[model samples]
Target chain A: MDSAISVHGLRKAYADVTAVAGLDLEVRKGEVFALLGPNGAGKTTTVEILEGYRRRDAGEVRVLGEDPGKAGAAWRARVGIVLQGTGEFDELTVAEVVRHFAGFYPTADDPDRVIARVGLTEKARSRTRTLSGGQKRRLDVALGIVGRPELLFLDEPTTGFDPEARREFWELIRDLASAGTTILLTTHYLDEAETLADRVGVIARGELVEVAPPSRLGDRHRAPATVAWRTAEGAVEATESETPTALVAELAARFGGEVPGLTVTRPTLEDVYLRMIGEKA
Target chain B: MIGLAQRQGALEIRQFLRSRESVVFTMAFPVIMILIFASIFTWDITPGVSFTQYFVTGMIATGLMTVGFQSLAIQIPIERDRGVLKRLRGTPMPPWVYFAGKVVMVAAIAVVEIVVLLAVSVGLFGLELPSTVGKWLTFGWVTLLGLTACTLCGIAFSSVSRTARGATATATPVALILQFISGVFFVFTDLPAWMQQVAAVFPLKWMCQGLRSVFLPDAFAAQEPAGSWELGKVALILAAWCAIGLVLCLRTFRWSLDR
Candidate 1:
C-alpha cells in the first residue's frame, strides 16, 4: 500500500504482437527507479500503462494506489509524466508552455522557478521551436515537475543531451528525488541509470530480468575486480583478483610505495547491463 | 476546466495569427472571395434580391464551413502528429478539454468571419440589416447551431487521417464539393438534379439554407427547393448532425500514437 506503483500479471498486445507479457514489478514511494532495456523491449509500453496513457490487455496495475486504466483527473493530478518527446508547441515560449501545464494540476510549482531549476532561466521568453535538443529535453522535465506531483515518470529524459547538460539534468533529477518525489524513468543509457536511479530494473522481452541497486547489478561488486597498474618501464599490467585490496598492497610493497597508476576497477554498469541483456537474448 | 480550455483556445488563436498563410487563407481569403464574387455577379436571384446579397449569405456559409470544418480538420490531425494531443493526455486536464479549446478558437473564427462578411455586405454592397427581433434571433440560433455542427463534424472527421496532409486532402474534397453543390459558390437552384439531391443529405446544405433564411428577405424564400427557406428543417438537420458528430468524436479521437 505504501508503494507508488504496483503491477501483477500485466499483459498488453497489439494485433499480432505482445508488448508487455506477464510483467510484475513494484516501485516504492519516494524512490528513483530506472527501468532499463533496449529498443522494442516493452519499456515504453509498460511506462505508458503505468502513466495511464494506455490500457493493458490484462493486469492489476496500480499507480499512486489507483488503477491507471480507471483513474480519473484527481489520480492524474498526482502523477507527472515526461513523455519521450513533446516537440510541438513550437509557437509557445518556454514560460508559456510551462505555465500552461501548471494550470492543469491543483497544486503546482511556480513556472518561473521550475524553468530556472531546469537551467532555462535565460531562455524563458524564447520560443520552443528555437530551443536546442537538450534545451527541449529540459523544458520537458520542467513541465513534468511543474505539477509538484507525488510521482513522476521520465522516459529517456536525457537522450540528446551533451555530456555537461546530461550531468546538469542528472543533478536536477537528484534534487527532485531529494525533495521526496517518487520518480520512475526508462533509459538505454546505463551510466544515467547508475547516477540517477536508487534502484535499477532491467526489462527484456516484456519481462523483468533483474531489479537491484546500480552497484549490485549483474553481481558487479561481488564479481572479480581487475587490479591494474603501470610499471616503472611504462608498461601496463592488469590481473583479475578476488581481493583487489590485497593485490594493490602487494603491488605497492613490490614498488616500495606508490605503485604507478595503481587502481582497482569493477565492471561498469554498461558491461553488466549488456551481459545481462545478451544473456537474455 | 473551462478556464484552461480558454487559455488553450487563446494560445491556438495566437499561433493561428502567427501563421501568415493560415491567417490569409482562414480569415482573409473568405473576404477576398466575397469581394471577387460580389463584384462579378450583378444580377438578381429573383426580382428584388441582388446576386450580391445572395452571394453574401452563401459566402457566410462558406466561411463557417471553412473555419469550422476544413481548417480544424487539418489542424487537429497535425496537432496529433506533432504529439500535442499526446502530451495533453499526460497532463491532469481531461483530453476532451483540448478539443474544447479548439472548438472555442474555431467558433470564434466562425463568428469573426460572419462579422467581416456582413460588414462587407452592408457597408459596401448596401445590403439591408435584419430589422426585426425575430429575424435577429433566427440569425443567433442558426449561427450557433451551424458552428457547433460544423466544428464537431470537423473534429469527428479528423480521425479519418493519421497525417496532416491526409486530413487536409480528406477535408478539402468534401468541403469544396459541398460548396459547389450547396450554393456556396453559385446558385443552389442552378446545380444539376443529382448534385442538389446529393447535397441535401449533408449538414452544410442545411446550414446554407439556414443562413439564407436569416439574411435574405421573406420573398426570397420562394427560390428555395421546397419553395420556402425551410428554417425548421435547417435547425432539425443541424441539431441532428451535432448529436451524431459528438458520438463519432467520442468514439474515434486518439489521445496517443499507440500502445
Candidate 2:
C-alpha cells in the first residue's frame, strides 16, 4: 500500500475531556511525517491511538494495512514504537536488551549494528541505568529499530537531549527515512519538524488545524514580510510589505547607498505554528 | 511462542541474578527466618516430633509464598511503573509469553530457596528428610501447586497497587498476617478457631499442611485439627486457589499503571 498510515474521522475522549475530536490524517510510504502541537492538544493521544496503545472512540484507523486495535502479532511485527521514557532496563546492558527484543521479529536487524546506528556502540556493554539520559534514549531507539520495522513511531524521542545529541539523533532518523521506513514523529521542537518532516501536521484543540510541508505551512511562503530599517534619527521603522525586495530597493535609493539596519523577513515556521495553535506571536 | 517465552525466561533470570540486592533478599530472607525460628522454638510438638521439624515445613511454605507471592507482587509493579511491561506490550511477543517467563523465573528461584531451606533444616536443626518415594512425590506436587497459585495470585494482586512502594506496603502485611494465622509462625491446631477458619480460606495454610504431611512424622498427623494430614482436602483447596488466581490474572492484570 502507498499509504503506511491512514485515519478517517478518528475520535477519542478521556472521561470529560475530548482528546482527539474527529481528526483525520495520512502518511504515505517512505515519508517522514511529524505531528506537532502543544501539550494537551491531542498530539500524544493521537499518536498513542495510531500506535495501538489506545483505542479510538470513533472512526476508522489503519496502519500498514490493518486496524491496530484488532491487529494480531504479525501486524505488530511490522511496526516499531519508541515511547516516551521507555528504555528503562536498569540491570541489563544495552546489547542484552536489544538482542532480547530482536527475537520477537521474523526479520530482525543485527542488534550490534542497531546499537551502532543509534550511536550507542560504546555503551552497548554498559548497563542501561549507567548510561546518560541521551545514551538511554539512544538505547530506546536501538530497541525500536532492532526488529527492522517498516513503520516506526517516535514520541518526543529527543525531549531532553542536548543540541549535539539532537543533531545526531536527527541524522539517525534521516538514515532510517532514506532506507524506506515510514516515520511518524511527535515533537515539540519546531526546528526538528522543519528539519526532518516531509510534511508536518499541526493539531490544536483535538483537531488537525493544518498539514503541509514546513516551508509552506499555513501559506507561509506567501505571507507578508516584515521589513525593518533604522532612520537617521536612530529610531527603528518597520512596515509589512508583500514585496520586501522592492521596498528594500526603494529605501536603499532614498538613503543614497544602503538602508541602515535593514532587515526583511517572512514568517518562520515557528511563527506560523504559533498562529496555527492560536498562541500570540 | 515457546521459543520467545524461553528467551524471555532466560532474560528474566539474568536480570534477577544481576540485581544482587534482590537475590540476597528474596532467597536469604527465608533461609534466615528458618534459622532464627528453628533455634528459638526448641520444644517438642508431640511425643516424638520436635518444633523444629514442624517449623521447617511451615518455613518452606513461607519461602514459597515469599518468592512466588510477595516478591512477584512487589517486583511486577516496579516493572510496570518503570515502563518495562508497556515496552514489552509494544512488541510482537504475546502477553502469555511474558507471564510464562515469570513462572519460569519464579520456579527456578523457588527451587534454589527450597534446597537452601532443606539443607539448613537437615544440617542444623536435625530435621528429617522424606523416607519414601510417595512422600517425595507429595513434596514435589505441593511445591508446584503452591508456587503456581502464589505466582498467579501475585500477578493479579499487582494490579491493585499503582507504585512499588504501595505494593510493598500492601503485600507485606497480607503475607505477614497470613503467615501468623496459617501456622507459618505458630501451630495450626493451636491457633484460634476463627483464625483457623480464616487461614483455611487462603492457600498458605493448605500449603503448610500439605508440606507438613511430607516433612513431619506420620504419627504427628494426629495433632492436626482434622486428626489426619487431609491430603485430599489440601490438594483440592490449593487447586481451587490456582483456578481462582488464574481467573483473577486474566481479568485484572495490566501492562501499565495508567491502563
TM-score of model 1's chain A? 0.92
Task: Give each model's whole-structure lDDT.
Answer: 0.88, 0.91
Per-residue alpha-carbon lDDT of model 2 for A1-281, expressed as tens digits? 79999999999988889888999999999999999998999888888888888888999998999999899889889999999988388899998999999998889999989999998888889998899888888888888899999999999999889999999999999999999999999999999999999999999988988899999999999999999999999999999999888998999899999789999999999999988888511
Superposed model 2: Cα runs more than 4 Å off = A279-281
User: Number of clashes in every candidate structure?
Assistant: 0, 0
For residues B159-198, what per-residue lDDT tens digits would candidate 2 score against the true structure?
Answer: 9898989999999999999999999888888999999999
Candidate 2 TM-score, true structure as reference? 0.98
DockQ of all predictions against the true structure, Cα-based:
0.68, 0.76
| lDDT tens digits, residue span B1-259, model 1 | 6687898888888788777788889888878987898888888878888988888887788888889888888888888888888888877787767877888789778878788888988999868888899989988888889888889899999999988889988999999888888888878888888989999888878888887888788987888999998888888989999999899998987765585
Instruction: For all candidates in order, state the fraction of native interface contacts they contain.
Output: 0.76, 0.74
A1-281 in candidate 1: lDDT tens per residue?
A: 78999999999999988888899999999999999998888999999999887888998998998999889889988888899977468878999889888989899999999999999999999988899998998999898899998999999999899999998999988998999999999998888898899999999888899999999998998999999899889999999999988888888899999899887888999989999889878
Native contacts present in candidate 2, fraction: 0.74
* Cα RMSD for predicted model 1: 2.4
Which regions of candidate 1 fall more than 4 Å away from where they truly are? A227-239, A244-264
